[model samples]
Target: MSPRRSVADTLETRQRILERSLAIASAEGLEGLTIGRLADELGMSKAGLLGHFGTKEGLQLAVVDEAAAVFSREVPERVKQAPSGLRHLRAVCEAWVSYLEREVLPGGCFFTAATTEFDGRDGRVRDALAGMNALWRRDLRIHIRRAMSFGELPGDTDVDQLIYEIVGIMLALNHFLQLEHDAAAPARARKAIRRLLGG
Candidate 1:
């Protein structure tokens, strides 16, 4: 292959690896990603996989990054056109619900599974997950503050508490949809959100 073609091939292979890794991690937790298993699954050599990522932790971190990118595309990016403050907040939440409902990953939310898997552990993977979760919470806080300023929400609204409840609704939606196989969970979640926002 020409040098440019070789580079393109390498990029394609790396993307394929990360895509498969994200799916497996979403369903089975990051602990389930073994190089040998991936190699067998992809019909690639273990060394080739290792070359793509220098170590298992490296691969896990890369998968986490890919998951974050996917989330950005599915949720926040989809809501970018909404006017800021309450409208943006509502749009993003609906986008989140839709993303989960659509089953973007074979499993439910990748972060939900990852956080459960690594919450007790200490490592780069856990830190990366935590950072992403924190950023999400922070984004919610920003929207809440904006809504308050715009008088969409009461001035005395408990920002942290509202965020907690909103996140709780999404978590419950994921559980109901995935574990209980509840088809109405998304509607219920939207109802709860509207109730909380008084919309």
Candidate 2:
């Protein structure tokens, strides 16, 4: 029998299940995630697991939010730890590459999977993913603007264009890392970022 869980313990258990669910979704896509599979993975009863998620949509939404929170917490912290301007921009690029390479999601990057999974779908999941993408793009714009202010980048640089370029680099690097064993992509990305930032 499972040990008796206090109210707080139960909440913590639910959090763990949600985190694991995201990882599983990342690894196998959302279609492969189910309450029964999660219960088996966690060594709990299906009914008990269902009690936490209630529905598949509920579980999917929770995973999307969790993935966003994870990115917000990790990437900025790494960037902030670096010197401002060009160095910070480089650090942010490195942090992004490292995050994808780390395989925080078993399938790959959470956004990468989500965009492919729900991009054209009209519903809560698509909205959630879109919002997450918007937020990240905004954050990147802020950094790019700061870089400009510091004279580390061109004065006439378009934030949107820079963001698009950076996103493309990140996506390319992610796919290369996922398909090949080469670490060259990250270095290549750093070089590209340096060129754009005028390092």
What lDDT score belongs to each candidate, Candidate 1 first? 0.96, 0.81
Write model 2 residue lDDT over 169-194, tens digit each, in one string. Answer: 88887777777856787788778866
Query: Which residue pairs in model 2 clash with each other?
Result: 26-107, 27-107
The window of 10 residues in a row where model 2 has the poorest summed lDDT is: 1-10
> What residue pairs clash in candidate 1, if any at all?
none
| Cα lDDT tens digits for candidate 1, 69-175 | 99999999999999999999999899999999999999999999999999999989999999999999999999999999999999999999999999999999999
Best by TM-score: 1
For each candidate, what TM-score against the reference? 0.98, 0.89
Model 2 per-residue lDDT at 115: 88
Report how far residue 141 has shifted in candidate 1, in Å. 0.7
Measured with C-alpha atoms, the lDDT of residue 62 in candidate 1 is: 98
Provide the clash count, candidate 2.
2
TM-score, cand. 2: 0.89
Off by over 4 Å in 2: 1-5
